[model samples]
Target chain A: MTTLTREFTKGLWDEIPLFRIVLGLCPALAVTTTMENGLGMGVAATFVLVCSNGLISLLRNVIPSEVRVACYIVIIAAFVVAVEMLMKAYFFSLSESLGIFIPLIVVNCIILGRAEAFARKNGVLASLADGLGMGLGFTLALTVLATLRELLGAGTLGLVFGERVLLAQPFGFFQQAPGAFVALGILLGLMNVLSKSGK
Target chain B: MKSYLQMVLSLSLIAVLSGLALGGLNELTFEQIQINILKFKKIPAVADIYEILTGELSSEERMAVEEGLLSEKRYVDLGLNEPSLFFVVRKDGAPFAVALEDYGQGFAGNLGVMVGFEIETGNLVGIGITTMSETPGVGTRVKEKAFVTQFMGMSKDAVLKVKKDGGEVDALSGATVSSRAVAQAMDNARAFYTEHREAILDAVNETPGGSS
Candidate 1:
């Protein structure tokens, strides 16, 4: 139980993805234009990570080392397709907004990284806890980035906060591709400073 | 040899299981996904046609119109089992025009357009872009009023191609491909409306608020 707790808590800060591990910057940069988009993408990815991690851990013993990557990819793809279909069916608006990124989750390094580095050697419960923690941490990082971008880029807080505009003249630069890098870079610097202070 | 066989067997088994699960899920969600596309994509385009025909709709009015249109779904039989659905737009409580969806090969994929035709004269009421994967701010400008409004009140017999192709329509400055695609969809609408004029008329007449 302590092991499980340790595995879970590490993802929250110590090994938090994007900010710390830096596994999925592609989506982290692309979908963080709005808080709603970021949250939606994070939740979708989390679903895939948890499912794939648990499944991979369960089959870890049976899967031959030679064919494990192929097996993991197939499992991950199946869950991604399931997420795509479910999102389209129920969360149609969000599905439209997230667009191609949902399917692209199949190739996200974060899910594959956890499967290869952690889940394969771990127990199923521990893998699940690790996946949950990593997923939530990713969600947190994406939401914070998106809030900064949306607040400055579009001047609105998005659907969660009734899309109220907080800026008199929001800088449009923060909404574009280069802005994602700038915001991420600044946040990463802040994270490093805080971590060093804690140490 | 035994190890090789185990690898082959396990990989095949995983693939088969994943295939079965995804196939089942696809079957379950196919219908709902189609409905969602119609609601979110097709209906809003129809509402755009409504806005053009009458006037700008306030948010409340647009919502009410969309709700009414959803409940007023009508279909024209095109030898398909499910039949093709179309929306009728009313002006002054009378069925003034009918809107149907058609598609053209766009730069990225199929570009869907909801085309409105005047019922009395068969002239075009206007067009609305339904679904597009064109480049944002470039090719996507084909959906803008400046581009689409050119089709409004055009005669059915007029050639529906961009000026580069010897037609009257002017293409967007930097997005000739997407502009041509919208023209292609307009041409398709003309052909479809001509081919199924009788059936479409009958369907509209049968509608509760439609006229003979």
Candidate 2:
């Protein structure tokens, strides 16, 4: 595989953010109560991640090492704020639902982690691919978890998609914080088993 | 010393560039963002007031009323450079009440309240919280029906201060600052309504389509 494809695909499976790397659990747990919220957050984060990654990679040589973290934060915050303004302008309801988490994206460890561990050392194109891959991976994990929780907790699918009621009664536990932890734990265990069996 | 200079120079350059980009983006989206906030936040709050004044409305009717309210924007120039925006609430194809927003300092920052006032009687129709960053369970209770219903039907000249300040308004338990913020916003609203009553009524009446 080419370097770009390798970097991109790795985020899909090998380093699938929340599940494998265990980063960005805050938003993952907070916004995954519903499928729509998870998806909305995922798209917003992807925008920020891609933009920040590309910019950081392009400026890696110019940014002094001693102040790289600060520079990265400035870039990430600008993108996050831009996302916020755009979301409010166009996707008002979704922006309302996501609330502070959209602004809090500036602090999401996933973006900073990638900037330090990958983008700072990689070329701009490679960093862009990596960001897109990681972002999509994060989106995938959030969607899967949110689908499970929403199905079990609400007995229906997303309201955005015209909620389809599946179960007559749903377990309400999966909609709360404790449930998020338990569900994440089980998913992690499941991933472990799958990885083991694959080998 | 050379490396230090580079660090400062680079950091400052990045910060300045980021600020410029954000400022420009904010300018570009400022109008749209305002419309969105009015649609999503202020409109809903006014709808809450509508529900309180006139009985409940079906979802379709509520949507119609919200749409009408958006088009009903009237400006009152309080000598504040730019004319302040307020909305008219129509009843039975006539101007019934006017809704305007005001803000007060809260625990976190500014808490916005949209208040409705009856045109003829000069009585407060109701109040709905437009925006607040108060504590979720405690300060946020100010948005609850129990807390807000207290302001319903209050006369225009009534003292809009909390009981803590020797006024009739009751403060929310465990959230004095937020409760005070609501009272303060109401005071500001009352002042605006009373001062610009003629201008507001004239603006609403002059408009062609008051029916929705």
Task: Give the alpha carbon lDDT tens digit for every residue of A73-184 in model 1.
Answer: 9999999999999999999998887888999999999999999999999999999999999999999999999999999888888767775678488887898889999999
**Which pairs in model 2 have colliding backbones?**
none
Model 2: runs farther than 4 Å from truth? B51-62, B75-85, B101-113, B124-212
Total clashes in model 2, counting residue pairs 3 or more apart in sequence or in different chains:
0
For model 1, what is the alpha-carbon lDDT of residue A43?
95
| Alpha-carbon DockQ of candidate 2 | 0.70
Best candidate according to DockQ: 1
Clashing pairs in 1: none
Model 2: chain A TM-score against the true structure:
0.96
lDDT of 1 by residue, B80-142 (tens): 776777888889888899999899889899998899999999999999999898865579899
- Model 2: per-residue lDDT, tens digit, A96-144? 8788899999999999999999999999999999999999999999999
List, residue by residue over B1-212, the lDDT tens digit for candidate 2: 99999999999999999899999999999889888877899989998898886788999999988887787777766678777778887788778899999999999889999999999898999999999877655798999988988888888778888898988799988998999999999889888888888888877765533321
Instruction: Please name the candidate that would achieve the greatest TM-score relative to the true structure.
Output: 1
